[model samples]
Target: MSERIPVFKPYIGVDTAKAAVDALDLGWLGMGSYVRDFEARLGSVLGVEGERVVAVNTGTSALHLAMLSLGIGPGDEVITPSFNNIGDFQAIRQAGAEPVFCDIDEETLGIDVEKAEALISPRTKALIGMDYAGIPCRLDALQEMAARHQLKVIHDAAHALGSRLHGRSMAAYGDITIFSFDPVKIITSIDGGALVVETATQVEALHRYRLLGMDQSARRMYTNERAWTYDVADRGFRYHLANLHASIGLSQLELLSAFIETRRDACRRYAALLAGVEGLRLPATDFTDVAPFIYYVRIAGGRRDDVIRSLSEAGIDTGIHWIPGHNFTLLKTCRRGDLSVTERVGREILTMPLHSFMPAST
Candidate 1:
């Protein structure tokens, strides 16, 4: 009999279901002890203090709140890679800032600092970077670039939960770091994200930002007290992560190291098995310290469509990581320059089936 494979699957088991039920039975389903515990464990993983991490319900919300707390507004720009999910650009536009699409290094497919330097204008307030598939972004170069420009670094680490660079977790490399726990990602809290803000001022701002600009008053209400006082320092959103979601996160965190190793082993095995496959160029990965989020390969000579058709016919589901933000309709009216690499790579990238599902073959 022939075996089937899945594109993306998480390792949520019986324990996860039990934990969720228990949390819900407690009747405190909002951001409470479970959320706090998850944040604490997550902070420990990032090598940060417990107070540094603020858990939210989605990665986009994390980015939106981070931008609000970072004080990014209209007329400001945040430099990011042109080849990325539209959501990144959407978050920038949502924050009332312009996302300056920068070119990426072809080999690692990460944001290129040199191109970012050229795009830097007086209004460039922050640098947002993504790992592109659990591979750490060129942090040393990116940090230097942000330092020279005096701009803050906010990492969109949706695909880099278990990744590190130069022996340091990716979270430590940015002034602000955001991670996603969506079902398809490295781990899932069903759907969650977190913002890491180390400073007191940023934390205070973030508190208000996530709870709809009602920082202190909201906290008092939760404690059954009437603090009929509030101020909207700035426009914010309802971005808090629920306690039930955090319970699932806590259960998953207990198994992240093992989860990372499983992904690494799968990636290595896939590389070994397909190394001899002709006409396919595997993604360039940083094996030193990174998790394998998704295994992508390039199909050369215009065979991408053909290869995909063949795979789909065999019941295999696949996907493209992104469509190159520079090519989007939103940027069509803007004066966008040549992002030749992004335009070229967008057509060739294809993520394969390598999640934590498919049973081992004999």
Candidate 2:
């Protein structure tokens, strides 16, 4: 059998291993200096104030915290694209809010702003816009609509950490942005995420929320110290990112630029190679402005499953980025607008193997 090609792989190496070992050797593993360092470095990369960035255990935690910080609760509703990951929907539910499903634009595979606007009602409190496959959503429009309607916006940038919009980092534009550093993401901390907000007050709330509502100062924690005299005032979770994972994240952060460049090159190659193939629709962008996560193609004529089987038999793995939130039984009864584009795209989208520093032969 030929060597199997994975749909996603972390670019781990000796340096990453050494970083983990060194972090272990430090004897301070939980939410310590390394986590602080990771958040600082990530903030610098995103051109945001370090204090505004809060590290969490996973992308979903970041979403949940963002929802909590924004005061979304049982009576509130958050508009989100149904053609999105389950994490986003669960996060909304975790905050005791209902997720109002919206449609996506066929071009960007992002929320259709017009459709989303129509879904807004008196109960609507927020909107969650995610970047599909590292392609940015219509952020400016989303922000404008949110402001006009007096609603908060959460930018689910799980797949777009290094992606840019109009030459600015996606983090720079959104009201509140969350990034995933999962094993299969553009960068990995094994399993971690970060939230970037606009104010120190918001940061303080996230800090308390991520660390079990403790009023302990993060400054002391960064030096690997803890205060037993802290107070807990509100609901919180054990969502803090540990030093072990943050150490890996810091190492991975050092190579993000290179990883993004190589991934973009691979995506360009895929687009070029797959062009003119029958019964397929490729991504619309040229990938210059995007970080290029998983390169996907829409297989027509109900042949997506057949193509997946063929690829698996050839020792090449493929993936379905998502199954669409509305199709799930839990979300089936959620309020929604026209999901025509989402339902069609959900059935057709197929992600190909993509990784950093991919060899030419791959």
Candidate 1 contains a number of clashing pairs equal to 0
**Model 2 worst lDDT run, 10 consecutive residues:** 333-342
lDDT string, candidate 2, 1-362, tens digits: 77899999889899999999999999998999999999999999998878889999999999999998888999899999999999999999999999999999999999999899999999999988899999999999999988999988899999998888978998876678999999999999999999999888999889899899998998899999999898899888999999999999999999999999999999999988999999999999998889988899999999999999998999999999889998999999884668999989999999999999998789
In terms of lDDT, model 1 sits at 0.81
On residues 1-362, what C-alpha lDDT tens digit does candidate 1 reach at each position? 35556688888799899889988897887767787788889999988887888888999989888787788989999888888777778888998999888878877788887877888889999988888888777878898989988998988888998788878887888888999999888789999999988797787777777777775643443332444666677767888788889899999888888788877877877788878688878767635477878988877788999988998888787888888876778875332455777777888889988665434451
Q: Show the colliding residue pairs in model 2.
A: none
Q: Evaluate model 1: give its TM-score.
A: 0.93
Error of 1 at 15 (Å): 0.8
Q: Candidate 1: where are CA atoms >4 Å away?
A: 1-4, 217-233, 286-288
